[model samples]
Structure formats: structure tokens, C-alpha cells
Target chain A: MQESVDLGPEQCTLLLGAGITGRVALSSPDGPHIVPVNYSVVGEAVIMRTSPYSVLGTYGRGSMLAFEVDWFDHERWRGWSVVVRGRANVVTDPLELDRIRTTWDPQPWAAGARNLYLRLHWSEISGRQIGVGWDPVETLPVRRAV
Target chain B: MQESVDLGPEQCTLLLGAGITGRVALSSPDGPHIVPVNYSVVGEAVIMRTSPYSVLGTYGRGSMLAFEVDWFDHERWRGWSVVVRGRANVVTDPLELDRIRTTWDPQPWAAGARNLYLRLHWSEISGRQIGVGWDPVETLPVRRAV
Candidate 1:
């Protein structure tokens, strides 16, 4: 199994819970690209599907990137966030595709968008927590559990 | 006017358009706090409001945090996203409070979920673009436009 880089509790639980996460990618001089994709935690990595015209189709292959997922409230004044930094690539192997399809159900927001599955291999993972007891902004060891 | 963090096109545009974005904070030993906030771009920063009991209040002074927004589709496979890194702090000053109140409209999904406004003084901002074009990943310097 590949070594997973686990940042912290803030970052780890987010992947475990199926939540909407943002996928950030680098644009080639023209513009910056952003996309919100559905993700599921498979062991130690984030797996999701992108569309054909979607940015994932173009940038999903061996691209340096960042992925973030977070939630917050104003009245309660408490929330948490997690960021995973690493390279994102396409999952082309048919066996892997079958596995992801069985485990993760990534559906498109709008109709007619093409679909492509991609995975982010996290290199550096870090996270922060707010409004629990005390001790915030703890960076976890690589792939260590909370 | 307060200084705006330099963000790439991806970050700026996403903050301006996406329907949902979230601010992530770390407070407890369990994990980072994640809350979905409704926000609008004012000047150059992302703004949102929370009540005294809000989780953001527990983040402490000079707390490190992030605000993220994005849009994506799986069919055609095209989308974009943006992330803002900055310090999370309460708005105690009257002028700041009035400004936040005047500019921000925190429409919580549930009633009484928001009341106070917290402005993140952004610092060291960076983001990337992916798959919008032929190139996969593009990393660029972040700057506020206009």
C-alpha cells in the first residue's frame, strides 16, 4: 500500500466523512481553475470523479494541486477545515475504476457533463480545529490516525 | 482600506460566483472545525457573520484559518475553485462591526445559526487552476483584480 500523508484530526475526519470538498488546480498561465467535487475516503486517499470538459479531465494527470474541505457557523461561532496538498492523477486502470465505482458514488451536479475518475495522492497534509476544548492547529504525522 | 491578499484568478472568481463556500478553523483536540458560510466578496476579502456562541469565537485571537469556494460538474467535466488563507479574529471594533454588518448578509440554512460577523485578515494567499484549458495544472501568483 502507498504511504498516506495524514495531516491532523481536522484533516483526517473530513475525508472519512463523505462531504463536498473543493479541488484546486494550477492553470497554465491563462487563468486559475476551481471545482467542487464529491469525494469519498478510501483508506488513506481521496477519490472522486470529474467530467470530460471538466477541469479534472485536463488536470487530473500528475498535476500539482491542493484539495480542501471545511464547515463553519456564525451563531455558534465554531467550525473546522482540512487541506491536502499533493499530486492529482487520473485513475485509468479498469480494475481501479471498478473498485472506485463500487465504493464511491460521485454524481454530477448538472446534466450532460462527462465523467472521469481521479485520485489525489496527498504529499503534505495539515489541519486546524476550532471550538472544541483547547489546543488548535495541530499538524499530524504522515498518515497517523487522530 | 484594508490590504487585500493577492489571489489568483481562480480564487477571486470563485469567491465571486460559487453558491457555497466555507471557513475552516481549529479549536478542539478532536479535529478542525468546518462550517459552510454564505458570503459575498467585498473589496477583496471574504466576509461572514456568526453569533457569540459561534465556533469561530473559540478559535482565539490571531487564529490561523482558510475560506474556500468552488463550482464543478462531473458530466462535461469542467469547473473552478478558490481558497483564501488568513487569520481568523472577532470584529469588536464598532467601525469594523458596522462595516461587516452593512456589507455581509449571512443567510443561514437554519434560522438563528448566525449573528456576528468575523473578517479574516488574509495573508500569504496562493491558489491554482486546473483543466479549464488544454493544460492540466497551472500555478500562478495570487493578486486581487480591480
Candidate 2:
């Protein structure tokens, strides 16, 4: 963890929403298969769909994986990013899928809907935020208002 | 590509601007470093930045990497995602950095400025977008709008 790369509470608040998460897939010393997925954040975990035929299906489930979601506003010269380090596994419980389907919206844009939902339950959560004018004290006083 | 995945073109258009991009680092066998970054589309390439001492500085440069940027409007069930398969390396040359800096803004949010510009030169670029109401046909044409 570098001091220069610091993400504050304000930035972390933004990442809780349902955004497109970058799903990173690691090969077994073979090659690379990475995909962008639409996901919903549940508690400390990030969840998305999977295809049994895809590389993610092969490497991600029951494996250590990484998931990230970010937002940046250039005009304001400000941005925030969140990274979740965890193990990924396929969700098989019918009740879990039903609950997810009730609240979670899996917007698949590809040609196939395999409906293989995966969850990356975070073991370590770290983030950093960068902006032009971020006064810690100025923002600190506002925190008390909440 | 799965047929059940409904991706639309509007999602692609949104990802082209200064949106969120995730960098997946697979250096360590167990935990791959995933970081969210603010990025912009330069030609077909995805460009982003980080601090000099960031995790990306260690695992990112000269590595076979996967970069994905996406945005979703959950309320409308509309979103688009783009994934780039390429090698990521730090732009060392001052002229090259100058050119990238002109197009990409990698300023951090904390106190001091810590922006280390990098580019994911694409070897294979593919994207998918999905929208709710309209038929996937006219909204998400496969070809990139040049």
C-alpha cells in the first residue's frame, strides 16, 4: 500500500452501487482471458454472472480472484477507485439465485445468457481517491453533519 | 459470446469518454491485483495512469494484461462494457508521455500529484453492450463506429 495512492471515505461511498466491474481472469501459466461484467455489490462481496464455457468459468470459480469498479470525472479532475481481493466461486444454491434475481439486476450484453452467477467475497478491501481540491478538514467538518 | 447477453451500442458510446477502467494484475499466483482507473479511449487503445510507486508499477509494466471499462444505468437496465486484451507497459519516453498526458488525465485525488501515465496497447479488442427496452439489433451493432 503506497501513501500516494490513497482512497478516502467519500470515494468508498460511491463504489457501493451497481456498476460494471472489471473481472480479471488469470490463466494456469497458459494465456489471458479478461472480461468486463455488469455487477451488483452485496455487503462486502461483488457478484456477477458467468458462462460455463468461458475462461472465467474455468479459472474463477473456487479460485482466488480480483474484481474492481471505478468512477472518474475529468472536468473536475477528480476520481475514485475500489479494488476487492477475494476468492471467486460459482453460486449453486437455488435460494441464493432467487434472492439475487429479486434484487440484483444482471444486465448481460453478450449473445448468451448462461446465468452462471459468481460472487467474489472480499477478504481485503482497499481504495484510493484523487482530485484537484480535496481539503480533508473542509470535508471533515461536513462529515459531522451526517 | 453468449446469446442471452444483451449488449447495446449506447453502452459502448459511454465507455469511450472519461469513464472507469479496471486493470487486472496477475503477477501473484493467489491474489491478482485489480485496480480501478479513470481512462479515455485513444483510437482503439485504452489509456490510464497511476502513482509511480503504485501496485501497478510493480505488476503492470510489460505484463500480459486485461483492461475493461464499462458503465451501467441500473435503474434503466442499460449498460455497455469493453474488454481489451493486450500488454501493459509504462510510457517512459518524455515525448510519448507528453502525448498521452495531453489526451489522458491521471491525476490522483489525495494531496500531492501522483500520476504515472500508462497505456494498454491492444492486441485484441472486443466489446458488448446491452439495453433494456429496444431490440438488441439496431442498438448494439457488432461493428465499432469509426
Candidate 3:
């Protein structure tokens, strides 16, 4: 079977920049929640706009969260996944908000007043890629009926 | 701007069945992490296979986690997102394992002995769709120069 490869920090960052949409995972009072978000990599943080009343915007600030992006091919059974873990904080500074608006101008695809921008200060970034070639199932030993 | 529509439980489950790939979010000692996994809907739970030593395999069992799947169109700026929250459990019963194997064999694209089957017993399923029509930005009031 083809082996998986570990991606370095540089490679992970590069992949993060290339993707515009990803899933954000956050721990909330209700439990862990995962939601798709449109984000932009600005400086060292991932920034996205959300409504203050939304689940993410309400519980995300000051919480540990994870952001992930991946590309997979089901036919070929090949893919790459990147995960970033960090603390999420609201962009409250007016100047910083303006800078982000001018630089990235993150537009929320869902029509709403998603005026609040949140930045995840990523502390760890890691990724892996499932290279193409052999299939895992094809290499597995035959099983006897129970 | 076009108003977003809330998807019912039945609609959410329908989308889940149609999609084979989704992201699983779990909180670990380091922090929360999100990773993509190919899954199958069996009965009322989402099941997938992973390595016993993998982060999801180790910390996912009996832990509260989130699973998300989405389809987005960049040109149209429209999409639908579904989130499932539940506790993940490893399928240990031999009979159940045999049943899952027969019904839907989850083939891991990544190479390894990913024999451990993990199921997320979802307690809440919710989804939302961004309907096509007007754009929120176009309806926003003109910004005054700072």
C-alpha cells in the first residue's frame, strides 16, 4: 500500500493559503461544533467573518479551536488534509479591522450581517497527504468467516 | 438579499447520506482538531474506520465530537452546511462489525491497519442553506470615510 507523507510547517501554511473554505471546530457549552467557514490567511492567523449571534461567533472567542482544509479524490483514494489548532479571538481594534477589511475583505457567502471578524491565532499547524499508488484494502489479508 | 433557509432534520439526514466525506472534530489534550474522513451512514449513526493509534481513534471514543459536511458554489455564492454533534464510540461487537462490513465497507484511502471502526452516535443534526437571489453586500448601507 502507498504510504502517507507528513507535511512540514511551510507546506501546511502554503496549503492553508491556497484554500478559501474550510471547517472550524470549536468547543462550546452544547459540545463540540464543526462548521464550514470562508477564511483568508492574513499574517499568521486565519480570519473569517461571522454574525455575533451565530454559534461560532458567540462561543468561539477565547476558546481553543481547530481549522481544517482538505482535498480528496474518491476514485483515486488520494487526498491531503491540514489541521491548525489555536485560540480564537475577535478582531476588536478598529484600525486592525480596517486593515483586514482593506487587505482581505472577507465576504461571507451566506447572506447576512456577518460583520464580526474572528482570527484564530494558530499555535500548531500539521498536515498529511495520502499519496497515490496502491490501495490499502487490496493489501489486506483475506478474512475467514466468523 | 435572499434570506437563508433552515433545513429540517430529514433534509439534513438526506444530505448526509448523499455525501461520503466529512470532517470530524474532536477535542484532544493538545487542543481541538479537525480531520477529514470518509464515512457511511448506517442506522442512525455515522461510521468510519481509522487506525487505533490515530488521534481520532484514541481520543474520539466516548468523547463529544462534531461532524460536518458541506457543498458550496463560489460563483453563485450559495451552499448548504450540515453539522452533527454526538459521542464517538468504537464498534467492538463482532456481530455488529460483521454487519457493518457487509452493509458498507469503509475503505480508508490512507494506507495502514485502520481496522478500528468508530461510530458517532449523533444527538443533534442541523443544517442551513444559502438560497440564491440577492447579495448581502449590495444591500448594505454605504460606508462613511473614517
Candidate 3 residue lDDT tens string, A1-146: 44688877887887787666789998776677898888888888999889999989998888888999877655566778788889999999999888887767667776779888899989999988787454322322222121
Q: Write the per-residue lDDT of candidate 1 for residues B31-122, one digit (tens) a residue.
A: 33444555655555656666667656555235666666543333334444456666666667888666655765544443454556666666
lDDT of 3 by residue, B1-146 (tens): 33578888997887776666789988787667888888888778899899889889888988998999887655566778888889889999999898887777767777779988998988999988786453322321222121
Relative to the true structure, candidate 1 has a C-alpha RMSD (angstroms) of 13.6
> Per-residue CA lDDT of candidate 2, range B83-138, in tens?
66677777778887776667655444445445666677777655665543544334
Name the docking class for model 3: acceptable
Clashing pairs in 3: none
Off by over 4 Å in 3: A132-146, B133-146
Model 1 chain B poorest 10 in a row by lDDT? B135-144
Model 1 TM-score (2 dp)? 0.48
Give the Å error, residue B59, model 1.
24
In TM-score terms, candidate 2 sits at: 0.68
User: Per-residue alpha-carbon lDDT of model 2 for A45-143, expressed as tens digits?
Assistant: 677786886777777788777766555543454555667778887888988777777766565655565578888887876666565346322332112
Task: List the candidate numbers ranked by DockQ, top first.
Answer: 3, 2, 1
- For all predicted structures, in order, the TM-scores are 0.48, 0.68, 0.86
Q: Write down the lDDT that model 3 would get.
A: 0.79
On TM-score, the stronger of 2 and 3 is: 3
